[model samples]
Target: MEQPTLSRATNPLIDALVLQHLQKRFPQSAECLQRELASRDAAAAAPPPTNRHALLMLLAPPGDETPLWATAYAEVRDWVDGALDTEGARYKPELSRLLWPLFAYTYLELLRAGAREQAGGFFASFHADHALMRRDELNQLSQVSSAEQVDASEFARRLLTSRYEVRLSAFSRALLLGFVAERRLQLTLRMLNERIKLALPETLAPSDGGGPAAVALEDD
Candidate 1:
């Protein structure tokens, strides 16, 4: 694999984050910095983080600059739920499956935007509200309070690297997609595109799941 390069964008957060993020992977990162600095006194190469969490936090969308996280997140949250409520009604139980991933991703978005309180509070309000089978997933997500915690967690890693599979009838999927299309929630759509996969055949998908295995990603 090619070595990853880090950016020195002059953002103060990015500057400070480089060493901490690098040290997580390369324990000798301090020496690495000193050596590099010794040879090239005019410039410094930020050490990249081992995981995406740090980068996501530092590079979170312009939305993070909003004066208040709670207010801004509430708008996004209400918009997501409102869309679901309007478009999801006819799909019955199958459509409801989308909520967990949506809720989970919302918390992540807040966390990525440096809203730890909102992330924790959102998780707290909605975590235990999930169905019995999804308790494990909710628990896994709840462990994540900050980007550092997310970078260190296996489950959180899976949420990014793996897809959340839902066995949905074709019609239900169309309805779900229609709403997402109309609202154009870019972050939500991105999460769904990258983190979600649908098992189209009704016969192949599991009917009930509460374990990590239940929400496990599938390989194509």
Candidate 2:
């Protein structure tokens, strides 16, 4: 079997010898290296990150450069709730699952940005609605009042460092994107784009009008 090329700069003979030794004596190390290489390649092929804040700034009126994040957060929460309430039972449950993550992340972001009072108010306003569903997480997050506290909390670390996965039907996804775009909901758009990994059915067709071929929210 042909060995995979590890690098271009290394001598092939030396590379082959090193790989063979590692594979024989430290098989796990060889496997780890292969996984790392694959991860790097995948990251390289990924698209550039969207500067949602900068885009929001450009869209804002001349005197209002800063986003009213507190207001925007409430708008997104209400819109999502109302939209899902009207959705058919088939898709409503799955779509409604988004609220917990949205609430948690928005709160963390507000705290991270040093908006302690807004974060507290945001928490108070929405905590009851999610209490039954996410009681433990809400409790843990409630204790976090500052950026330092957020960093120190294990729950916050896990939530911030990883993407939450949600499955959505093509129609549901299209509806979400349309509403987000129409409302110019920057915070919601940023959350969907950056933190959520949407899984769509394999049989999705182009004519479905799902914004993108990939199961991701479009930046534009």
RMSD of each: 16.6, 16.6
Error of 2 at 160 (Å): 0.8
Which predicted model would earn the best lDDT? 2
What TM-scores do the predictions have? 0.54, 0.59
Whole-model lDDT for model 1 versus the true structure? Answer: 0.52
**For each candidate, how many residue pairs have backbone atoms clashing (under 3 Å)?**
1, 0
Model 2 is weakest, by summed lDDT over 10 consecutive residues, at 1-10
**Candidate 2's TM-score:** 0.59
Model 1 Cα lDDT, one tens digit per residue, 43-90: 443433344565454434444342343343344445434534433333
- All candidates' lDDT scores? 0.52, 0.57
Model 2 collision count: 0
Candidate 1 has a TM-score of 0.54
